[model samples]
Target: MNMERRGFPVWSIVAIVLIILGAITAGLSIETVPEGSRGVVTKWGKVTGRTLGPGMNFLNPIGVDVISVNVRTRKFEQIEEAATKDQQDVQATVVVAYHPEPQRVGQIYTDHGLDYEAKLVTPGVTESIKVATAHYSAEQLVTQRAQASDEISKIITAKLAANGIIADSVNLINYQFSADYTKAIEDKVAAEQLAKTEEMRVRIVTAQAEQAVVAAKGEAEAIALMAKALADAPDVLKLKQIEMMREKWDGIMPRVVGADGMSLLMTTGE
Candidate 1:
């Protein structure tokens, strides 16, 4: 009876211990990495230069730790107030889309933790905004917003890429100035437009006056030509006098005075 009891309890204990051991072994040998993420294995807080891809991965869990890093594209957005070359205060929203290089995941995690955005991208963005804004005046910044955005993108992207981060795109979403500045710009534009209208009116008046002078000169030239033609042929003057008399005569008979001092009745129509 004692042998039976001892054997049964011993076997039960062995089975229980085997189950626990099996669970521990399974836990240590197996790991799962989620999509859009990569895992870096480390030993004693030191990276082992090994990285694991997404899905089920086997690892030596007893002496190793896997740090899962998000290799997916991430975005950082910030609104910053900066000064232009003209000393105008401008506000801009900067957006940066970045991701860690998949092959450099281990190096990235070892060098900078998952909080790399705060450490690297933020400063790069801030500095880029300042550098870009300083090169243009307030008016230029507003007028050439696209160019300014491109410049900001170049500076930030170059800086981030040097630090092992891939910046896909950087953008200046919104660029604006103070309300007072906008109002001033509007007023200045209005004044300029008014000046242009007035100048156009003046030009029109001047052109009309020039046309009148040209017409007067044309009439004077016609009179001079007529006088010259009369002087060139004295008979033309007599013919013109006869034409005037014929136009003035009506049905009444006109008296014709001859050079011999004799008067005759001239009939216009029989």
Candidate 2:
């Protein structure tokens, strides 16, 4: 009876041990890739070049590991400093949207590992922005912001593509300049406005001066014309004298005469 009981107990222990090993093996062999993610398979601490899509992935349980990488669009912001073409220091906040090429996730893992943003995207963005900023002056950066962003996006796209990342967009969010530079720009705008105002005032004064000169010329011309008309006709002077005599003489003539016996015209009251 003791022998039979011992034999049954040993079989039971063996079964239990086998079950545990099977469970452990299944746990290591089966990997579930979450939605919007890809699994990178590595064997013996080396990339196996096998990429698993979303769902259950089965692999050799021995000497195998799987890493999940998100393939969805993600954004990261970076504040970087660069010098403009005119040697002005500008601080820019840049936002980058990107995603791992789903098919190339394995390559990305091979090249940059899971920390793709830090190793791959970040350096590309920094270099591209610096290159682009160096092509524009401080004022051109503000005025031609769209062109600058496009150039940055193009440069970064090419850079990240070489490393298995797809760059969706690169945007320049904000720009910060030194206080002295900002104040200088403000002062320049103010001076330009003041100059425009002064120019308008000068134009108005010149117009008024021209009008005054025309008015004076017209008055002088009218007076000269009247003097010329009188000088051209001697009969006009004689007519003026006759009209004055008629106005002063009444119906009666003067009886007193001078020594030469010439009659003097006079009014009745005189």
Candidate 3:
């Protein structure tokens, strides 16, 4: 019985040692905060008011909660269908680039929680798209889509900044209209193209007519210049007459047929 009692004390000491070792192990447990991320730690259901950065971080094993917020840039795509100023239904697909301010991440988490995508980002994007698009007509939306996208981006950035989120840029990925509207736009574009083609053809014909007049003027001026030159130099006229005679005669003697009893003979090389 004494031996058994002594063994009991030893077992008690072993169990105590194991318990102490377990407690130490638990206390030594640490988490790593990745680069470009901030760790928010809460103690006993209250935020600790301190943010942890990259590397191993210690926290209370029992009552502390550590939440990691990524400081890197993130992209979100938002799609919405809304009515334009002209009451035309359009679908807008937008992509937004954003990043949480590293210094403000803790506050953002506290205020927005983990589900900021549903609570803040999406709503902001949708609202901005709807509001900005509402100011433009369907034709304007199609033709000046870039301007509409810029306006929407500006509004979204401003709104997100107000809520502690930093938006880098918003891009309109695609804008689609109803099939009937698309067909109408295509037809209108075709008509405009046809009108432009007709205008171009008319311009071409007018240009051709002007060219013809200019060419005729040039020919008349050339003829007057030739006459002036020939009048100034009578030898030029004789040389031209000799060239014409050589071309008209083939070195044959001239033959004359008279019908009015008057005969005139012209000899070659005369």
TM-score of each model, in listed order: 0.64, 0.61, 0.69
lDDT of each: 0.87, 0.87, 0.85
Comparing candidate 1 with candidate 3, which one achieves the higher lDDT?
Answer: 1
Error of 3 at 14 (Å): 15
Error of 1 at 42 (Å): 1.8
What value of lDDT does candidate 3 attain over all alpha carbons?
A: 0.85
Residue runs of model 2 more than 4 Å from their true location after superposition = 1-28, 189-270
Q: Per-residue CA lDDT of candidate 2, range 1-270, in tens?
A: 474576766667788999999987865567899999998888898989999999998777788888899999999799989999999999989898999999999988887788999999899889988998999988777768898888877988999898888988878888789989878876876898899999999999999999999999999999999889989998898899889989997957667676899976665652
TM-score result, candidate 2: 0.61
RMSD of 2: 10.1
The better candidate by TM-score, 2 or 3, is: 3
Model 1, residue 72: what's the lDDT?
90
Tell me the lDDT of candidate 2. 0.87
Better of 1 and 3 by TM-score: 3
Per-residue lDDT, model 1, residue 90, is 90
